[model samples]
Target: MRGVVMHAPGDVRTEELEMPVILEPTDAIIRVTATCICGSDLWPYRGAEAIRAGGQRMGHEYIGVVESVGGEVARIRPGDHVVGSFVASDNTCEICAAGYQSRCVHQVMMGSVGTQAQYARIPLADGTLVVTPGELPADLIPSLLAASDVLGTGWFAAVAAEAGPGKTVAVVGDGAVGLLGVLAAKQLGAERVIAMSRHADRQALARRFGATDIVTERGEEGAARIKELTGGLGAHSTIEAVGTQESMEQAIRATRAGGHVGFVGVSHDVALDGAEVFFSSVHLHGGPAPVRRFLPELVDLIFQRRIDPGAVFDLTLSIEDAAEGYRAMDERRATKVLLTTD
Candidate 1:
């Protein structure tokens, strides 16, 4: 099998690797059909996050066919086409039962397992894998793959922000997740969606995703613009899809009093001012999205062709060319990159 390995910052390679097998009763193995690069992966690639001693495996989002399942696995069987959450959870634990599978007691971070490969192991198979209605059409594969991570995360952001009918929603960040957040907000019944982006292409896509307005200004200016658009009261809900000091602050400052702010960006060196948040009078809720909680509904939406979240993948490359995909994203030439295993 071949997989992606990051030898150091700015150095990602595709190389032959060992095949995965079920090592636990809750484990299952799958032949990866599709996988992609994530914005979070850039943290290590750009040296913002430290790499392990030797190197680290990359990728967490995946959709594939089950090759085998452990003895304890039920519900998911071999030959099943499945999509799973980036974080594997038993789904039977207290936290999981409460709809926070991302923090499941027996959670396994799939990034360490590396789904960007020919085959990979999935833990908590019965709880982590969601079988599609039947065999999937090739045309729907990209969207289904998006449901495994980005789309689910974005949807979670929208839900956490309390986007609903008659409410004005603002999204901070124009990346794939942020763009999809716009879509989620609209789907959740937000009356008005504001997308903050400087890129014309992203702005266009944001509009296509139901963004009624675009604000190019960032940071404080961007927050001010959001408030201005909402008649100085700010948005009823704000989605913070970028995890940074500026983005976080902007999101909080852009929401009206008693509003909600859903933040899903992988936080990196973000420090919040106590006084600012104390006076903001907004509800803040978000973390690594509990994607497992929404997989079924999202998959249904994809099957119905109700949402084309896959449009975010403007660039596609063979798995062997993943390095270029990373470069394209880092250079702002692509909104999202899909790495086809086939």
Candidate 2:
């Protein structure tokens, strides 16, 4: 089997590797049909996140047909087409029971599963995998794949932000998750959805996703724009999808007092001023999204053709071209890149 390995910063290669097999009672093996590069994967590629283990395996989002299941696995069986959460969680855990599957005590981050390959092992199969209804249209594959990560993450951000009727929501960042955040806000019934994006292409998608306004400004100017649009009250809720210090602060400052800020970006070099947060009177919450919690509903939406979040995938490449996919995203030439086993 061939899999993506990050040898070092700016160096990712798809090379032949040992195939995976069930090593746990709760494990299942799947032949990957589709996988993709994630922005967080860039952290190591760009040297922003340290690769403590050299030649670390890459990728977490994937969808495929189950090839085998462990003795303990039930509900998911061979030949079922399934989408997995980025985090492999035992849904019955206390943490997962509290709606935070990402922090499940018995969870496994699928980045190590190396979904960017021919076949991979999925632990906690019953809790982590959601089978799509019957056979899906070829075109719907990408959208269902998005539900494995970005779309679900974005939806979690919206829920964390308390987006709902009568609420004014603002989203900071214009990446795939950010774009989906706009979509989630609208679906959640936000009265006004503001997308802070400088890119024309992203702005267009944001609009199509129901962004009521687009603010191209940055830092304080961006915060001011949110305030102006909300009549000096800022937004009732703000979604921070870019994890940078600036973006985090901008998100905090863009929310009205008593509002909430949900940050879904993979944090790199971020430090918050406690006093600033105290004075802002804004509530903050977000971490790795509990994608498993929302997978069922999102899968239903995609299966019903009610939403097409796959539009965020601007580039599709063969698994062998993983490096190019990374480069396209790094160079800002693609919004999101999808990889196919074929």
Candidate 3:
């Protein structure tokens, strides 16, 4: 089998590797059909985070056909077209019962779980894999695959910030995560959506995803613009999709007093002043994003054609060309990159 491995920073490679097989009772082996590079994966790609030396499989978002299943993995079986959530959770834990499967007691992150491989061994099959409606329609695969991560993450961000009817919602950042946040907010019923974006393509997509306004400003200017748009009080809700100090401050400042701030970007040296954030009366929440929790709903919406978040993907590549895909995204030449294995 072949898989993607990032031996070190800026050294991602496609190489032959051992195939994954069921190693636990709740496990299943999937013949991957599609996979994608995520913004989160960029942290290690850019040396912001340590890349595990050796053959560390890269990628997390994916959907596939079940190739084999353990005896205990009765919920799914071979030949089933499915979308695998990034978090492997039992779906019966206390946190899962409360609709937070990303925090499930026995959760396994699929980033290390490695969907970039030709074959992936998915633990907790019953909890992680969502069978698509019958055999997957060819056109539906991309949308279904997005539900595994980005779509789910965006939905969680919207839900966390309590986006709804007549609420003024602002999204911080213009990456795939942030653009999708605009889509999720609109679907959640936000009356007006504002996206902070300097990129023309991303801002254009943001509008296509339901963002009503695009702010090109940064830092205090951006925050003030959001407030100005909201008549000087700021938006009622803000989604922080960039985990940097500037993005965090932009989210906090754009949100009005007592407003909610949902941040999903992986934090990087962010130090929020309790006193300052407190005085602003902002409620902070977000982490790895309980992606599994939103899986069912997001999948259903996709199947029904209520949303097409997959449109965020502007570049496609064979798994072998994934390194170029990543480079394209890092250099802002692509909004999001999709990799195909089959």
Lowest lDDT 10-mer window, candidate 1?
49-58
Q: Extract clashing residue pairs from model 3.
A: none
lDDT of 3 by residue, 91-127 (tens): 8889989988888899998988788978998888998
Q: 326 in model 2: Cα distance from truth in Å? A: 0.3
Model 1 bad stretches (over 4 Å): none
Q: Write the per-residue lDDT of candidate 1 for residues 28-87, one digit (tens) a residue.
A: 999999999999999999999988778788999999999999999978999999999999
Candidate 3 steric clashes? 0
User: lDDT, candidate 1, residue 196?
Assistant: 96
Clashes of each: 0, 0, 0
CA lDDT scores, all candidates in order: 0.94, 0.94, 0.88
**TM-score of candidate 2 versus the correct structure, residues matched by position:** 0.99
Question: What clash pairs does model 1 have?
Answer: none
lDDT of 2 by residue, 244-302 (tens): 99999999999999999999998878999999999999999999999999999999988
